[model samples]
Structures are given as C-alpha cells and as structure tokens.
Target: MTKQYSLKHIRNFSIIAHIDHGKSTIADRLLELTKTVAERDMQEQLLDDMDLERERGITIKAHPVTMAYEAKDGQTYQINFIDTPGHVDFSYEVSRSLSACEGALLVVDAAQGVQAQTLANVHLAIDRDLEIVPVLNKIDLPAADPESVRQQIEEVVGIDASGAIACSAKTGVGIADILERIVTNMPPPKEPEDDLLRALIFDSHYDNYQGVMVYVRVMSGEVRKGSLIKMMATNKNYEVQEVGIFTPSEKPTDSLKPGEVGYLIANIKNTQDIKIGDTVTSQKNPAPLPLPGFKHISPVVFAGIYPVDSSDFEALRDALAKLQLNDSALHIEQESSMALGFGYRCGFLGLLHLEIVFERLQREFDLDIISTAPSVVYKCLINDGQVVDIDSPAHYPDPSTIESIEEPWVVCHVMIPSEFLGTIMNLCMDKRGSLEKTDTLSMDRLLLTYKLPLNEIITDFNDKLKSMTRGYGSFDYEFDNYRESDIIKLEIKVNDEPVDAFSCLVHRSKAEAKGRSICAKLKEVIPRQLFKIPIQAAIGGKIIGRETINALSKNVTAKCYGGDISRKRKLWEKQKKGKKRMKEIGKVSIPQNAFMEVLKTD
Candidate 1:
C-alpha cells in the first residue's frame, strides 16, 4: 500500500544558504527522516547528482523532490523540497526557483556565523516575501556556537530569534524538530477558484527524446494529459502529451493541480518555445491577467568566446544556443575577429558565471574554447552628442571623439581575520578601491566595505584576495552606479603596425606598468618564425617600450649518411619547406597569451 495526500496538505519550499554551509546536507537528512529513500541507499549530498557538482561540493542547479513524513499526531503530510544553488553566479536562477515555493529554509553555519553571500541570499528571500525558517546547521563541529549565530541572524536580518532551530544536519540530531517547525510555521498555498487554467513556468530544460520539459507552479489551473495549452508570452499553442509531479529523481504521475509543482511535456519541438517566465493557460478559458513574471536579467559582464579549433565554430554556436534555452542569463551573438576567426560575443552575470559556461561547453559538448578576458559594459558619450554602449574593446569610441567616459562601480563587502586586515587594505588600495567603512564582526574578525571600479573586480581581485588571506576571507559585490574618471587608451603595435586585436582602455595611472607587463608576457609566449617580431606599446602613435623575438636559424649542411645522399638531401629540402611554413607563423601577428595576460592586470 502507498500513502496519498491532498494538494492542501503539501508544502513546497527551497533550502538556501552560502556555499558549503550544509544546505544540501540538511536536505539529505530531511529525506532520511521521512524515509523517502531506503536507509541502505543513502549517499552524501544526494541532490548534487552531477559528477562535476559532486566533485565541487556545490549544487549548480535547482533540484526538487517529494517525500511523505508522519508527524507525532499520527498524520502524514507531503513535503516538496527544492534545493537551490548557493553562489551569486546563480542568483537569478535562485530567484526563479523561489517563485515555485511558499517559503524557504535559511541555513546558517553555526561555527562561521553569517557570511557575505549568506546575508545576500537572505535579503533576496525577504524581497520575495517568502516566509523564512532559520536553521543553525553544523552543530556537531568543534567550533559550533548556535547561540551566537542565532543572535547574529536576529540583529542583522531583523527577524525573531525565539524559534530558530539548532541541528547537526550530519548526525540527524534535532532533525525531527526541524520537520515539525516546517509544518507549524510555513503557510499553506492559497487555493485558487480553478475557474481558469493558469500556471507560471519557473524552470525548464530540453530532452533529446522528449523535446521541451517545463517545470511550473500551478496557481489557478488544473492540467492533465491530452490538454491543449497556449503560451501567453510567445502566443504559441501546443498539446500537452504528458504531465506529472517531480519525485526528486523523476516524474511519476499522470496529472497535476493547483498548489502543486510538476513537469509538463508538450510536443513543442523547439526548446525556445518554452521560456522560464512564460505563462501556460488552457486555450479555451484563458486568464485575463498574464502570470507575474520577472524582468529579464541583463548581463553585466561580457567576453569573447572562441573555439581553440576554428573548425568547431558551428558546433560551439549550437551548443551555446542550447545552453541559453535552459539559462536565460547567458546571452550570445555572432562576433568576428581577424585574429580569432569567427566566434561569439557572450554576456554573463559575473566572473564565476563566465567560468562555468566555458567549463560546461568543454565538458558537456566536447568542444574546446579560447575565451578572451571578461570586461564590463561601459557607458560613453561621444563628442557628436551621441550615447554609445561599449562591451568590447573593438567597440570603444576613439578618444578624440569622446566627450566623457563613465565606468561602472560596485559596493564591495569583505570579511577577514583581523590579523590580515593590513594586507587586504593594501591590496584594495593598489586596485583603486576606496574604503567606505569597517566594523568588527567578532574579537578577531572584521568586515570591510569598499567602493571599487568594476574593471578592477573583473581582473584577478578575487583570487588575490583569497591568496592573501590564506583562503579565510569571503567577499561579494553589487553594482552601485557609474562615476566619471580619467582613462587612457592602450595600443599594441607589432612590427611597427597597430594591431586592433591587442588594444584596450585602462586607467591613466596604471597604463605604463600594465603595458610593460603585457608586452613582456607576449614576448615570452609568441613563437619565432622566419622573421624577428617586434612588440611595442603606445599611448597614441609614439612607442613607450619594445621587446623583440629573434627569428630561428640553423645549419643544414652538417650530416650525410653512408650512400644515402638522396635521403639527406630530402631532409634538407624539407627543412627549407619548414622555413616557408615558418613564414606563416611570422605573419600570425598576435601572441598566444596576448588577450589573456592583458586582462590579468589588477
């Protein structure tokens, strides 16, 4: 016999926290307490099923599961748990995931207290007006102090601290109490009249055999197999061939109703037909108002994406387009470069998002990619009274034609041990970061805020901060506004010819050192050919400094074999042919690391 519960008795919620803060572990413990999976079949962080995600110990995507738990009163209730990604890279995805939930479980590390990302995610939950159930996780660790963490959450987030739960998601202690709190505190979904069919698409993915699979939160609709549906956003209609609820691993039902979260399979061959924020309604009794949707996320970071093998251009385009179907945050367009061949101009939310996209392309699609340095969008006003938006160095307006240039800035928060405060402050100063304020989080810990140029954050700032702090510092930033600043245009010349592919704009004070370091790195990696190469950096037309790469030369008349004169002559002839091939290398123009080394300047 199997257990069954009505829609009114179900509670759909998501677990959110900072990275490595035990959100997934707590989810696993919840599953165990409810006997959702057999005890012998348990695994660590079970929701992170992807091999990459498991290795990294982070959840890259949102996953939903259903379980039935019996309370002390001898009544069974269905719980639909959603595990969301904890990094800022997936913040937009987290927002979309929250739309399918009535509340969220905010997990905080008892030993570490609240981190920058922890506060950021908690604020996001509050903005959505989702009921928050705070949990102090990792109570079994040696440094665990649940009382202090509870106080911090109350003071920082301005929430009631009386009902906070303390539990070791690892040892299963206090797990039952956490479950009881969920049933008592979290509100049930408000039932709709069911007079019209309406549902909000929160997430979606493509399947090779099943076409587009959309995950929706039913608001006022009842949908079943063999129903005709219309997408209000796209004005396209389709026949729903199958419908079922997500069982953490798979869909195992034939229909879904109001207050339920489930997946619907429509015979819409193209994945683009089903967008993340689109609305699905019955073709006969469509609702008057469209489902509440979020404004599309505009990318703040831009970069050039190229395949290591130029022949894979089409494959790369197809792969990115497919990824964009599932990820609305990824934006791509056709881009061409004489040096890089045909590629793409892709936009991302941040640096981590950029890295993840490149990694997925190489791992999932089996394609090799060469990405240029990531850059932020710059707002410029031309001398002709025209406003221009520049995302790439190629699109930067000529200095002579610009009236003023404004660069994006961010409000940055950094938390570190007090002993390393001086080192971090020096780093911030060197990167043009202006300190806003500093406060003590504990006796030996400090929280510092800075207003820094976005250009600095796009460089190696994150890695350098971690390295200087011995991996103990945590930081996050949000776009504040733009400020007017003095800027300089850096141009690189090869063999006394200006190379558009090696040009960039940087702050005036840092231009000289940046130029020298870039040229030095280029001289080391670019291979010599039949002719020597001259690398130079310039402000306008006059060269500042230069480095030369000597051409290769060798002796061809050294050896002969016993009566094998023809073979030796053939070998020498091949060497002459190699010299001709070397000519192509000399004309290659750009260094192998030219694009990457320039972007490394902090």
Candidate 2:
C-alpha cells in the first residue's frame, strides 16, 4: 500500500491444507471480502496463474498477495498472505511460503476429516513456529460433521481446535469471520532492532522486458528505487531500478518498509544471477548478519530429457535454463548418452513433479522431448571408502568394486476407508513395503503407515493406491534415513550395443522379470533390419533375457526356379555371408519411438 503502516498494523500469514480441500476457494473468498479484487473481476482460483495448474486443479507454485482489510475495530490493516501448494511434492513451496509469514490458516474438509497431508502440513507449520488457525470448510455439504472433525483435529493433530471457525468458502458463509480472525488473532511482525536494510528473497521470476523480478519480505530498513543493494549469497551489487508490491498483480510502490512483502527490479540481466533465499541489504550499510537460508532440495526421482531433433539441442538448453529460473526444485545438468545423444539428466521432488516439468517443457517452451525411465538416487560405498551418489544407471560403478549400495526410503501415510485396508496392504507388500503402524482416525477412516523404498512409489504407486481405494485414498510421505539394500543395475543392449537411456537399477529379486519385460517391449518397437537384431537385457557380463527381431527376406532365388539346385544353394550361401558381414560392421539405429516405448515400460 502507498500508506506506510506501522509494525503493529501489518500481519503476515499463509494458507495451508491438503490438495483439493478448498484452499483456492478460501483464497477467492478472502480476496472478495477484502475487496482486493473487484466483484466483477473475481473468479475461481484467482492465484493459480498457470493453465496447467488450472487444468489439473492443483497449485504448483506458491502465490503471494498484499491486501488492505478494514477490520471491525475501525483500523486499516496491511495483511500479506501466501497461498501455498497442498501436494506433498510441493512441500518445499510451502516451506518457502511459511518462512515469509508469521501465521497460517489450516483448512480441513469436514467430511474427509484429518488426512495424511493435513497432519504433515501441521508439522511443517509447527516446526517453523507459525501460529495456526484451524478452519473447517465445506460445512454446507450434506455429510458435513464439524463436531467430529474438530475432535479429530484436536486429538489427532495435537492442536487446540475449540475455536475452529466453521465456514463454507463456496457459499460465502461466515467469510467475514475468517478475515476478522486473521487480523485480530494472528500476531504482527516482530520488531526490527536496526534499520540496515535486510530483505529475504522468498521467490523470483523472469520478465522479458524487466529481466528478473526478485520477490522480497522486508525484515528491516527500506528499499526504494536507485538504492544500491548487495545480494548476500552472490555478493553482487546492483542499483534498484524499481520497487513494488503485489495487489494479486504487480503494483509499483515508492518504497517498502519493515514488515512488508514486495518485489524488486534491479536491472538484472539474467535469472541465474539471483538465487532464492538470498538476503538483500543496502550496499552502503549492510546488515550485521545474513538471515538463515532454506535447506537444500534434493530430488527424489531422475530421468533423461533429450530433444527429438539433434539441431534443437541449443534450444533445449536455453529452455531448461529459463525453466530453472522459476522452479528452484528442478535439477538439470548436461548428460550425454550413446543412444539418446546430447541431453540433460533432470531431477524432481516426486513423480508428479517430474510429470509437470516435462509437460511444461512441451507446452510452455514448445519443445518436443523424450523422457527416459525415472530412477531414484542411490548412494554406493566403494571398496576404497568413498561414497558415490548416482541417479542414472549409466553412473553405476563396477559391481565388484562396490562395497554396498544404500537406497533412499520414505515413511508413507495413507488415509482411506476401512473397507480398502486389505487391498492397500497387498499393494504395499507387493512393492516391498513393510507395515510400521496403523491407527483409526475415526469410525470408518483408517490411517496406515508403511516404510517403502522411494523407488517403489516413484512409478505408479500413487495411481494404484487411488484405484484400489476407489479414489478415496489420500497419500503423503516424508524422507527417512538411507539404508543398504540388495539392488542391481539392469542394462539393455540392442545388437550387442549397450543403450544407456534404457538401463535401470532394480532389486535382485525382481531383476530377471524387469529385464524380461523391457526386452519384450523393445522387441515390439524396433524396426526390422537387413540383419537379425538381438535385444538383450543383462547385468554385468550375465545376460538374463533376450528377444530377436527377424531380418527382412531378400527373395534372391526368384529367378533361379529352373536353374540347377547347386546354383540356388550357392546364391543362398553368398547372401548368408553378406548378412554376417553387415551384422558385424553395421551399427543399429534406435528411433525416438523405440526409446519412448521402452523407457515407459513398467
């Protein structure tokens, strides 16, 4: 706002909940009640800007907006709230959003009660010392049970929910109460001891005309136009070209003071110069110490991304660089393969994260790409006492020289109706998961805890869980300690040539079957050649499965019908010799279709 609000007048908070549990709807109601957006301009999912997020009905990125709400106490309050993603893979986004806020609104569905993600988000908010206000949504539904939900919230989440506000965001019932509570109940920003200009870069994006737009939360001091500031992480100094705040959209401001969230345009030429979580300070009088940054985001799943045409390699590289500007969780580096040629090995938080990134590359950047089989990060201890972390099977070390391999695992919590417990148990057991604990949240809703390898769930584990439960299952997981596991690398070879893109690591018990299935899929896709092609799956020197693609017949004996039998035999023998020479000297070419089909094999 143009008016400089004192520290006590400012309230910074965030909205946290499970996916598809009325987070966006509540956000719409807040915006409407506060008059942040006009009644005519108001629409659903006001913060979800990306089309992909709208189509998928989920928030992929955290969105922040500044509002000026006039409360019942006859005081104008400046409220900054971040709407965070609810999916487990985007928990990092939630963390970033929470760091910028002093409190949070924990929304829960009355019918669904306490789900897995609800508990996980509660823990995240608690760890950050955020003041949480539990709100019950969808009370207008016929099955709404607010009393039982409140009890579950208190007993299951260990939080006092006696004053939980019961409201339906869809119908605008009790929306005023939610806003009033945010202003009166949430704590104000802490007092800044000094005014040396220390602002944290919570999020950032690139603009073609303005370069990089750095989002900031001013902890102390003021940042105005033409003020020289230094990025604490990079130690680079730049003059602030402009400063502003987001009114659900960018609005230029004369200055941003303490306890305010806004953006800065510093004439930055490129996106790579700025890093999320870096502290901003005035170059003339910098802060005594920098703020604590966020923890490193380690990707759980990895896959290879290559352009369909070789000439588009440079475009692919540029596209990835641009993509990394907004998505800090995405990891990409140059990795070349003999079969797939030049590409990058990208890492993601989970399977959904991987899918979204791939889809964005195709849709946003208009680039055609081939994604290889996804794999998990493995820690291999060598015989010489060195540990190597590898995400791609091409990086796997020699089997004899490795002392042990440790695979990452997660503790998963699934909330479903009691009727689906048996089938859920069978599915987890099939994925090499072990049951750890089980509890009954309500009369019919049950929570099951299982320890499963991260590799198991990166595939179709979530899909199967939803299918078995008839779409009533809600899943969430957190990283556990790494442990040694019996895993082996399965490599695929066509015509005796190893293909790095098709290789994957599998457990020893399932290696043969995995290899066999891969071989079968490759056999159906690869085109026939003049010489017979052998598709083999192997571990080291031992071949476990093989499929042969028959060669095309030449029909060279068509004119030799009346000739001597010896002449026909001679022609056939000559042809056989030619085929052997071609098979020995010729190289096999793998098409893009073959790569897609084989890499997607389950």
Candidate number achieving the greatest TM-score relative to the actual structure: 2
The TM-score that candidate 1 achieves is: 0.87
RMSD of each: 6.5, 2.9
**10 residues in a row with least lDDT, candidate 2:** 289-298
**Candidates' C-alpha lDDT:** 0.81, 0.88
Clashes of each: 0, 0
Residue 543 lDDT (model 2): 100
Tens digits of lDDT, candidate 2, 17-136: 887778888999888888999988888899998999888888887778999999999999999987777888877767767878899998999877888888887888899898899999
Whole-model lDDT, candidate 1? Answer: 0.81
Q: In model 2, what is the error at residue 460, expressed in angstroms?
A: 1.4
Local accuracy of candidate 1 as per-residue lDDT tens digits, 172-289: 8878998888777887777786558888887777777888788888887688888898999888988898887765656657567777777889876776666666789999888887
- TM agreement with the true structure for every prediction: 0.87, 0.92
> Candidate 2 — which residues are off by over 4 angstroms?
528-532, 550-588
Which candidate should be chosen as best, given lDDT against the real structure? 2
